[model samples]
Target: MTLHPIESGNFKLDGGAMFGVVPKSLWTRTNPADANNMIDMAARCLLIEDGDRLILIDTGMGDKQSEKFFGYYYMWGDHSLDASLAKAGFHRDDITDVFLTHLHFDHCGGCIINNPNGNGYLPAFKNAKFWTNENHWNWAVNPNAREKASFLKENILPMQDSGQLNFIKKTTKDSFQTSSELDFGIFFADGHTEKQMIPRIDYKGKTLVFAADLLPTAGHIPLPYVMGYDTRPLLTLDEKAQFLNEAADHNHYIFLEHDAHNEIITVQHTDKGVRLKDTYTFNQLFK
Candidate 1:
């Protein structure tokens, strides 16, 4: 199996929102903020070429949203999913699966787009079977006030409306499905959002986990540093503690999706609990 780092796009978000209650004095050390207190973030998705199935983990925030909507998040780069796919010798049509970690706009907005010829929205990847768990699907469609803004209808309903949406059955709330059909295991996490699926792939004798929002960046390795966006911040503390401990003990490589600067990171047990051991660029490690 081969892995390609898909550079979806880059944007900046309020550092306070990204780090939650964590003080700016602390988060800025790792993810330094600009004068506006906005920190750089990447919609860095992953493409897995396992046999004929080219699975894309997330699509990033697509370009379909209006300028006013996008202005809220300071977008800053030239990377686009289509352009990145071409760099990897592929296209949207080559993706057999659109594996969404969650239905947040940043993660799945590129899954749908305004119909080029007409008005309504449609699935961007007409051939790909969009993957999202049943619980997450329901949670997204009927979003609560806390998360309603993040789950946009245009980016979501088109898949189900078009009959391409597929659900991965969860054995347990946080169980790891080792025998998944996607040729990789998934650890379903509920802390960030209900049933946010984190994919675990076995590559070259090492376990690489797509650390969706469960572990957004290496700076989040510190136990108390959790995102305010989390509906259940307390649950995240426990989930992160357990996951980071395991990652440290097993020497797993964490593939970060949101961090633009730190592509991949590993954690180790320290007196202060799980702390980042090192960081690696996608090419530095994958090459």
Candidate 2:
């Protein structure tokens, strides 16, 4: 099995919102803010080529939103979903499965796109099945007031409407194997959302966990560095503490999603609790 890091695009978000209650004096050291106080963020997704199945972890924000709509997020960079797929020697049609960690626009917006005439929407990955759990699907479609803005109907709905949406069965087990050689398990964390599924994959004798929003960047390694967007901040503390302990003990590599600079990182149990041990790009890992 081969894993590829797909660079979709970059955008800027308020550093304060990204870091939550954490003081700017602390987070700024790792993720510096611009004059407008927006921090650089990448919509980095993962692509797994295992035998006949090419699985994409998350689809970054697509370019379908209006300029006024995108103005809110300050989208930047030339990287695009289609361009990234081409670099990997694949196309959207080659993707057999699209495993979404969550339904936030920035994470799954690339799932659908405007049709040829630009009159309606269509599934971006014409032949692939969109994977999202039942709980998250329900939570997203019927979003609460706090998260309503992040879950846009244009970025979603089309998959279900296109008859390509599939739900992973809920299981009590922490991890389970999929139908391919790229077998992976799911780690559900509620602090971030109702049932945010973090894919834990066993690859090349090492375990790689897609950090998703749970640990957005190396700066978020500390237990208290939780995102302010999390609905349950207190619960996030416990989730991070437990996940970090296990990640450190097992020497698992974390694949960061929103970290524009750092792609992957490992943690070690220090006196101050789990801390960043090392950072690497996708190519550096094999070297």
Best by lDDT: 1
Q: List the residue pairs that clash in candidate 2.
A: none
Residue-wise C-alpha lDDT for candidate 2, range 166-216, written one tens digit per residue: 988775654333523236878888898888888898888889999899999
TM-score result, candidate 1: 0.98
Worst 10 residues of 1 by lDDT: 172-181
How much lDDT does each candidate structure score? Answer: 0.91, 0.90
Candidate 1 residue-wise lDDT, 167-247, digit = tens: 887765446776366868888778899988889988877799999999887788898899889999998998888889889
True-vs-predicted CA distance for residue 221, candidate 2, Å? 0.9
Worst 10 residues of 2 by lDDT: 173-182
Candidate 2 TM-score, C-alpha based: 0.96
